[model samples]
Each structure stands twice: as C-alpha cells, then as structure tokens.
Target: MASRTTQILEAAARLVARRGVRGLRVEELATEAGVSTGLIYYHFKDRTGILRHTLEFINDRAERYTTSHMADAAPLAPRAELEEVLLLELQDAPEVRENSAAWGELRASAVFDEVLREDLARATLVWAQEVAALLGRVTPMAPAPALAAAGERLTALLEGLSMRWLSGGLELGHARDLLLGAIDAELARLQGK
Candidate 1:
C-alpha cells in the first residue's frame, strides 16, 4: 500500500492541479484521499508543507522520467540524441501533464511564497543541468557555457510550450510537433556550425 504521506501528496497534487494551490483545502484533500484532516497535518505540518512536498514529488517524477527516457540514446549522434530528449520532454504523458498543471500552480504560488520560489529556482537549475548534459553529448563544437545556455533555452521553450498546451492555447498534437520541429532545427543548426 502507498504510505499515508504519499497518498496525501498525490491527492493534494490532483486537487492543486484542478483548483489551483490557493484554492486547495486540507479538508477537501483529506476527503478525496479518504483520510481525515488530522491525517494531513500528521503527514504535513500545514498547507505550505503540503505544497512544498507536492512540488518536490512532481519534480522528482519528471527528473526520473526524463533521465530514463534518455538513457538508451547515449550512443546516438549529439543532434539525434538531443532531438530524442526534446521529443520525450514534449510528449505529454497523462500523468506528466497532470503533474505539470500542479507545477504551474506551484509556480504561480512562488510569486508570493518564499519557499516555493526557492523550490522553483532549484527545480529550474536541475532541469538546466539535465538539459546541459544532454546537449553536451551531441554538440561537441560548443563550449560548456554555450551548451549550458542552449540547455536553458530549450528548457524554457519546452516549459512555455507545455503551459500553452495546458491552457488550451494549442492542441496537444500541434504543440508536440512544433516543439520537436524547433528542437530538430536548433540541433541541425548547432551541428552545422
């Protein structure tokens, strides 16, 4: 069975994604999870604690998914490898999309919450580092700084695309195609240099 803390976090994430973090209520989360309000407090000290853990949970899953998806592409050319990574990042797995919604809520909350702001910064750094590692494997011509910058750019692009798709600005299929095409073009340009 999932631990109580895990259950609470998962429920809270779903609620936050659906209702926004500010709109989340402990009572609602507890009821959704089939637990009591005190159980939420037992696992998390308060609302902030729940939100922080929820963000961490989502980020952890994303990191794992990205890392695992890229694991087998190590031997491919840099451009191909980067394209594959971008494709994986752009493809919206249902769980990932839901988690991303939660992430968006957390990002908005970060504007007012110091803890969430710090968490967002940390998550961004982690994503940048992951992107840099993938880029380094493919783009041998660039210095580390340039490669890291490219990684940050790609990360930002994907994040923006995700937000747009989640908010119904673009269809999922179109967003994926656009992001993949952009990534492919960028990689080709990098490789041609």
Candidate 2:
C-alpha cells in the first residue's frame, strides 16, 4: 500500500496539474487522498513541504525511467545511439506527462515562491546531468567541451519538444523526426572533425 505521504503527494500532483497550484488547498488534497486534512499536516508540516516532496518524487521517477530506457541497448554508432535515446525521451510516459503538468503549474507559481523556484532548479540540474551523461557516452570522439555543448543542445531540444507536445503545438511524429534529424546532423559534424 502507498504510504500516506505518497498518497497525499500524488493527490496534490493531480490536482495541481489539472487546476494550477494556486487552486490547491490542503483540505482538498486530503479529501482527494481520502484522508483527513489533519493527516496531511501529520505527514507534511505545511503546503511547501507537500510541494517539495512532490517535486522530489517526480524527479526520482524521471531519473529511473530515463536510466531504464538507456540501459542494455546494443552498441551502435553515436548517431544511432543518440536517436534511440531521443526517441525514448520524446515518448511521453503517462506518469511523466501528468507530473510534468504539475511541475509546469508549480513553475508558474514559483515566480513568487522562492522555495519552489529553488526546488525546481535543483530538479532541473539533476535532469541536465543525466542528459549530459548520456551525451558523453555517445560522443567519445568529441572533446569534453564539445561533448558538453552537444549535451546542452540535446537538453534544449528535448525540453522544447516536451513543451510543444504538452501544449499540443506539434505531433509526436513530427517532433521525433525533427529531433532525429538534428541529432544525425550533429553526429555527422562530429565525425568530420
């Protein structure tokens, strides 16, 4: 069974995703979780605690999902490897999509909440590091600086694709093609060096 804290966090995340964080209330989250409002306070000291826990939970799941997808693949060329990883990242895991929406709502609310902003920045750094590691493994020919630059570019592309997909700005197929093409072009440029 899920712990009370986990249940509360999941409930809060769903509520925040559907209706901005500003609309989230402790009583509502507790009710959604099928617990008493006092139970929430028992698990979390306050609203900020709940939000922080939810962000950490989302980040942990993302790391696990990305790592699992990248592990145990057959060795391939840098271009092929990059394409594979991009495809995996671009495909929206339902859990991730919901968590991402919740995070987006938190991000907008974070403009006025320093704690939320800091939590988000920390989570972003963890994600960027994971992306950098994946890029580094593929770009062995490139120097550290060059590989790092590529990683940053790849991160940007992934983020952009995610935002576009979530906002219904682009179809998944189009985004995949665009990302694959960009990765292939970059790999070719590296190969020529």
Q: List the residue pairs that clash in candidate 2.
A: none
Tens-place lDDT digits, model 2, residues 1-193: 9877788877887787766667778888888999999988888888888877776665566556666765667678645666676676566777666765765665566678676676667666665666556666666666766666666777677777867877899898898888888777766666577
Q: How accurate is candidate 2 locally (lDDT)?
A: 0.71
TM-score versus the correct structure, for each prediction: 0.83, 0.76
Q: Which stretches in model 2 have alpha-carbon errors above 4 Å?
A: 68-81, 106-112, 116-119
On residues 1-193, what C-alpha lDDT tens digit does candidate 1 reach at each position?
9988888887877888788877889899999899999978887888888878887787676666666765564777766766666666455676667767877776677788776666578778877788788777677675788777777888888878888988989887898788777666666766776
- Identify the candidate with maximal lDDT: 1
